[model samples]
Target: MVTVAPTYHVPVLLRQSVDGLNIQPNGTYVDVTFGGGGHSREILSRLGENGQLYSFDQDGDAERNMPPGDGRFTFVRSNFRYLTNWMRYYGVTAIDGLMADLGVSSHHFDDEARGFSFRFEAPLDMRMNSRAGMTAADVVNRYDEERLARIFYLYGEMKNSRRLAAAIVKGRADRPLTTVAHLTELVQPLIGRDRQKKDLAKVFQALRIEVNHEMDALEEMLQAAVRALRPGGRLVVLTYHSLEDRMVKNFMRSGNAEGKTQQDFFGNRLVPLKPVNNKVIIPDEEEQTANPRSRSAKLRIAQKLG
Candidate 1:
C-alpha cells in the first residue's frame, strides 16, 4: 500500500490504476485529477530524468501537496476540462498517457465548511474549484422544480426525484434553502428511514454534479484527452459514479460519449482506441476493507490507436 496522508485522501486502486498507464520512462504524462498527489508521486517515481509530468487541479488546496524542486514536474492550476488548451499553451503537442481519478477527494467531504457531505451543517458550497463557479445552494434554491427534478432523476438515479424536487420547492417558498441541514431536512421525510443515507447521498451527488458541471466537463475533457494523446498513448480513468462511468466506457469504445460505432464496408469497427479491460475493474475485498469509500470505484483504461 502506498503511504498517503489519511486525512487528505486515500487513493483507490492506486497500484492498479497506475500500472494500467504502462508508464514510459521518457514519455510525457498528465495526471488531471491530482487530489492528494498519491498517484502523481508514484508516476513521478517511475519517470526518468528526461520525462515530464503535468498535474492539474483547479483547487488551490491541492497545490500545497506538490513536491518541491522537482525539475520534471509542472503543476497546472486549472480545471482538467481545458486539458488540450493548457497542453498546447505549454507547447506539448502530444502526451504518452493521462490518468484521471474522478472521485471527489476525502478531504473535500471531511472539510465541514465545504458542504460536500450531509453529515455536516455547513453552507451548500460544493464547488471543486472554490475560486469560481456557482455553489450548490445556487442550484437547489434557484433552479425550477422541473429542472431540479431532472438533475436528481438523471444524475442521482432517484426514483422519487419528482417528489423530492416538489418538497424542496415548497420548503424553500417561505425561506431560501441555504445549508446542508436545510436541504436534507426538506427531503428526508420523502425517503424511508431504511434508505435515508443512500437516498440523501443521491441528492447530494446530483447537486454536486450540477454545481460542478461535472458531466459536461467530463465529456469535454475526455474528448480533449483523445485529441491530445499520441498514437499508442493510454487513457486511464477511475470513476466513482455510474453517470460518469457510462460516459467513460462509451468513449473508450466509440471515441464519443454516445457509444456509437462506425464501420467500413468490411464491417470493421472504426474507433480511436481499444479498451484495455473487457469488464470494468473494481476494488477487491482487501482494498474495500482498507478503504470503504473505494467500494464504488470502477476503473477503465484504453489506448489511443495508430
Candidate 2:
C-alpha cells in the first residue's frame, strides 16, 4: 500500500484497449490487472457517478497506485483467477466489460530487486504475487532435469532445452544457484554471445511461467470471464507472449481452452464468446517506438453471446 513517486506501470495500447470495451456511462466494468491505474482512471472518467469499477491486482505495488478517493472505484487485492468469487462477494453477478493486460508489468522489470530482468544481478525471485508461491530460484535449484527440460521446451520454446536443463542440474550440484548472476553464468556459455539476451529472456520466461502457474490461472480466469459477464459484455485482453496470445485466441474463438467448438442439435456452434475482430490487433509503429516493451503485444476482443 506504499505509494512511490516513480510511475508504477505504463499501460500498453491504452486507447485501443479501453475503446474496445465499448463503454456505457452507467455500466459496470472490471480491470483485472490494475497495474498503474491508467486504464482504471480512464474508465472512471467515462463512468457516470453511479457507474462501478472493480480493479483487481495481486501485487502489493499495484495497490500503491490506486486512484485516490474515488468512491466509484473498488480495489480488490486478489488474483483475477477468483473473479467469480470476488464478484459474488461484491454483490455483482454481471459486468459490462472486463480488460486484462497480461504478462509482466513494467515495474517488475525496472526494479532490479524483483529479478524479472537479466540486466541486473539480484535474487532469482520472480513471483508476481511475492507474498505467496515458489520463486524462480526454487525452480532452478530444485526441479529435476526432465521437468526443467519440459518447461524450457514447452514454455520457452527453446530448441536446446535438454542441454540447458542438464547444464542447470550440473551447475546447481556444485553450488546452489540463488541469484540472477549465478543462473546467467551457468547458462550463458550454452547460448552464445550473438543471441545472449534473446535466449536468456526465453529461459527466464519459462521459469516465470512455471513459478506463477500462469497458463493454469489464465484458463481458469477465462472460463470465469465467460460466466461473469452479462450477455453481450466485452472481454478485452492484451497478451505480450505468443503462448498467452495463442491461448486467448483459442478461448475467444471456441469458448474452451482446447479450442474445440461444441455443436448443438441444429449443428450451430455453442460458444460462450464470439470474437469481435477477424484478426488480432497490434500496436501501431508510433506506440512501438515510444514504448519498446509493447512491441510484442497482441490484443484480442470478444463478447459473451449467451
Which one wins on lDDT? Answer: 1
Question: What are the runs in model 2 whose C-alpha is more than 4 Å off?
Answer: 1-6
Give candidate 2's whole-model lDDT.
0.91
Candidate 2, residue 162: lDDT: 96
Provide the lDDT at 98 for model 1: 98
lDDT of 1 by residue, 161-208 (tens): 999999999999989999999998999899999998999999999999
Query: lDDT tens digits, residues 94-185, model 2?
Result: 89999999999888888999999999999999999999999999999889999999999999999999999999999999999999999999
Model 2, residue pairs in steric clash: none
lDDT of 2 at 293: 76
Candidate 1 TM-score versus the reference: 0.97
TM-score of each: 0.97, 0.97
Poorest 10 consecutive residues by lDDT, candidate 2: 1-10
